[model samples]
Target: MIEIFGIPLSAFLSQLLLGLVNGSFYAMLSLGLAVIFGMLNIINFAHGALYMMGAFLAWMGLEYLGLNYWAMLLLAPLAVGVLGILIERLMLRWLYKLDHLYGLLLTFGITLVAEGVFRSFYGVSGQRYAVPDLLTGATDLGFMVLPNYRAWVVVASITVCLAVWALIEKTTLGATLRAGTENPRLVQAFGINVPRMVTLTYAGGVALAAFAGVLAAPILQVQPLMGSNLIIVVFAVVVIGGMGSILGSILTGLGLGVIEGLTKVFYPEASNTVVFLIMDIVLLIRPAGLFGKER
Candidate 1:
């Protein structure tokens, strides 16, 4: 066996691949949260629930409607995004005028309702999702056999993250979006519909989360409680990255996921609390987060 630092090279690289897979999902979900928080100033507690909804929606499409994976990829997120717009218009809009805590509470309630409803149907067990035939199997990398799907996951997520960052940071529409975030009244004075912009920003974020769910379906089980298990850790990622910086969110999420993976390999017990531990340390050293700007 090829060895590095007295450890089999294959073992180390495999763990790295697993870490990158996890990091992909973290980056996608955290980016969505950061976008919503930065623009709407709402800490969405329902994000996890939205992720669950994505899986359920895909299952619904497959079991009854006969939609394929590619189609569901587009349809699921669109459906979820539209629901987000409705939530914004009907419920979240009313709370935006009040304290941020109110928004959090309302979204938290939404999360519970969504999760509970899914649990009633799906039960506690996870349903199996088949990997597309194209993404199946593994490749020999001389030192290790790597799953094609995992590599696909990493590539897809990085592409999505970069595309979204470009849309938000480089485009004209992005300029408008950012301006609306900082000064809605001013943006509105110039005839841009600020409220509608806010609604769309939130919808975009929700869609991003749902899309991540679709990606996760093949590797992780498609279960009602899936998001509930991981959402808290994602929130920590958001805090550690600075809420407004899209790149910060992506880097912080991937970094933490790798750290967690390594902890599991070396010290199994600490894996559970590793992210939280880092969160506390970051809070102590820089309350603004690793890439956050001081307010």
Candidate 2:
């Protein structure tokens, strides 16, 4: 019976939860983007396609191999990560020394080709993925009923984000990665095999995307165009957080998700465009992005 601004508390909390779910996806995807761009300087327009591929891979494993959600959760990302490695070695590597536009174009083309291939067989209709048996029910929070799967998603996403942040910021390997990207030639001189490191970095980023896709599969339908539908907003999130900033991406993504959710509650008409509007405002004020270094 309680209300805030004439909106039921339950409705507001529900929207907030939905927003956090979305923000979890945004954080994961943009984290991948940040890693790839920061460590490899690749625009990776195909990231969304890879995400879709992950979801499809999970669905296929379930249908054909009788794999469960837990199994596919591991397998799908590994599969996509291997594919990402192939992509880097076979195609993306060649464009590294070239302009950033080249990498963007190549990845964009890959996105188109991937979408086309999937669409040819699957068509445009979405496929459903059921929630894992263990996470099938809802939990009664004192104020709101929370879906167990959604709670898992938020917890898992935040945990992953923190782990990745620590990996990049606190560890010796992370230091080497940052140095390798900044000066590959110098790192190569030290017998680090910088190229291999770069390849792995890209693979790791791709795996993160796949992981997100797997997480999203049960919530959203598995479809070819799913990636395209969300990629732009993820990109906006990355940009607003500051390109290549891990912490920025995580925080900004969660914050924006909550803001967007609240907008739906207060001003339904602007819900869809609210993120973009914020992006515009951020760009006007800080062109380097909220967390990016001015270079």
Candidate 3:
């Protein structure tokens, strides 16, 4: 058996693949965060809670409504996005002119409320979600055996990330969004509905988080507190990549995942801290983040 640094090649490859899976989730969640921060200038503290809600939505649909994964994929995001729209209109909009901290606090409160409610009913234990029948096996690669579901997650996340990037960077609508964020008053004077755009943008960002949650449901059991731990790591990713940079979020997420995976292989004790260490180094070198333009 071939070995590098006294570790079997297969084990190394397996860890790498697992890391990629984690990175995929980071990319999706961070991308949504970037979008929300770019448009609203608010760091949404409730994002993780909403993500938890999405997974629960999938679980509820399956258990109570007999909905399949494919259907829940569309429905969960739509439901959560609608909820986001309402939150913006009723609660968040009032705080736009206030300090950014107000928005953060409000969302944080919402997260607590949501998590508390879910935990009361579901208890601390996690609920299971079966992998879709279509993606229910593993394939043998030359160096490693790859689980089909994990591979699908990597592929699906990449597709979603690329599509979002293209939407924000290439299309005319994206141009308008960019312009609106830079100067909403001027854009409003030009007859565009800036307020409406802001509402839609928040909803869209929340939808991205929900979509990621749906993707994660089968892999990680549906649980109220699941998003709690993951969100902290994702925030580190956002800080390292810069808060509002779409492309930066994607690349940094994937890259950090692979680095974390490799760390697990070569230095097991450092696997958890490696990303934060990178974040610290990046902050020292470029406070605006690796891709952020200095303001």
Instruction: Using TM-score, give the best candidate's number.
Output: 2
Q: Give me the runs in candidate 1 sitting further than 4 Å from their true place.
A: none
The digit string of per-residue lDDT tens for model 3 on 12-127 reads 88998999999999999999999999888988988899889889999999999999999999999999999999999999999988998899899999999989999999998999
Residue ranges of candidate 2 with Cα displaced over 4 Å: none
**Clashing residue pairs, backbone N/CA/C < 3 A, model 3:** none
Name the regions of candidate 3 deviating beyond 4 angstroms.
none
- lDDT, model 3, position 41: 91
TM-score per model over all chains: 0.97, 0.99, 0.98
The stretch of ten residues in a row with the least summed lDDT in candidate 3 is 226-235
Each model's lDDT:
0.90, 0.95, 0.92
Of the candidates shown, which would achieve the greatest lDDT relative to the real structure?
2
Q: Whole-model lDDT for model 2 versus the true structure?
A: 0.95
With a 3 Å backbone cut-off (N, CA, C), the pairs that clash in candidate 1 are none
lDDT tens string, model 2, 1-295?
Answer: 9999999999999999999999999999999999999999999999999999999999999999999999999999999999999999999999988999999999999999999999999999999999999999999988899999999999999999999999999999999999999999999998899989999999999999999999999999999999999999999999999999999999988988889889999999999999999999999999989999999
The deviation in Å at residue 140 for candidate 2 is 1.2
